[model samples]
Target: MLAKSFALAALASAAFASPLVVPVSGGDTPPADQVTISGITTSGTGCPQGSVGQFLSADRETFTLIFDSYQAQIGPGTVPTDARKFCQINLNLHYPQGFQYSIMKTIFRGYASLQKGVSGTQQATYYFSGESAQCSTKSTFTGPVTKDYTVEDDLTVASTVWSPCGADLPHQYQVPDHA
Candidate 1:
């Protein structure tokens, strides 16, 4: 009886697997356009301890996305002229097509971190946007995707902020227009 129960459970789990193609409309071929995401930008500011020598470690900082891209970036694009407080980082693609790909996965992976310090704060914001076809509907995920971290002498604080800042694609399944 236990073996039979296990088989039923396995069969039920298999029924809820990810679908190959998300159905948008009832027709065989729904009106769709090819949307490609070339790249994403991760930018933010950091504040370090007051001491001149006490600096935040770039090695411990990160802004990553788990989408279909060629490479991810770590650390600031350019060294902050003022490293003590309010340092900024901007990373852009050198090549046009390096990180271009399609939007297959719904939940995109994102992460950011700042090392522990006497007193400091770090924030990473990722921006994602693009034009959508006239007949398509935009995604519910809206802008200013952000992650914030604070490092105090005693404790560390972190948070994940969501925004509608991602490649704008239409609904997976299409809907007919009303006259």
Candidate 2:
């Protein structure tokens, strides 16, 4: 009898411990209506000249960014073993109006594609959970609750020998402009 009682208590605790999961529309590539492109900035050696694109959901609930393509180096020396091409991406959530909340945790769902010395692709899906924080007196409430994350795994063309190279052959994130 005692064992059965303990089992019931454990089950109750487990149920309460589970967090509430919020459902979002965009899985990886957010639908057109669910995103807005604010601005994009690109800087790097691999693809120094690049562009930025963004998507903000119509309701302002979700935000996503794509940092085109940037040039990067994968190996050593001016003539690296591989000249990697990559890009950066970000997907996050925004607080709904009149609602107060704090993010307790964030989950990233996606895949990474690495092409030996060339271009690659990266996909990201973000899930967030938090406690409610009443938004009453606050005059201004803006921006995402979490950090602006980046994923640079895409490479364009691979080179067995680094023919065209530069001093800055590393990966770096550019500050995106707001739309």
The numbered model that scores best in lDDT is 2
**Candidate 1 lDDT, tens digit per residue, 1-179?**
11100000000111111112222333342122222222322222221222111211233111222121111122334233223222221222111111221222222122222222211212222222233321212211111222322111111112211112232322121111110
The CA lDDT of each predicted structure is 0.20, 0.24
Residue 86: error of model 1 in Å?
8.2
What C-alpha RMSD separates each model from the true structure? Answer: 21.0, 22.7
lDDT of 2 by residue, 30-107 (tens): 343433223323343322353534444454433343333322223224243233333322222222222222222222
Residue pairs clashing in model 1 are: 24-173, 24-174, 128-165, 128-166, 142-163, 142-164, 142-165, 143-163, 143-164, 143-165
Please give the range of 10 consecutive residues that has the lowest summed lDDT in model 2.
Answer: 3-12
**In candidate 2, how many clashes are counted?**
26
Question: What C-alpha lDDT, on a 0 to 100 scale, does residue 172 get in candidate 2?
Answer: 18
Cα TM-score of candidate 1: 0.18
Best by TM-score: 2
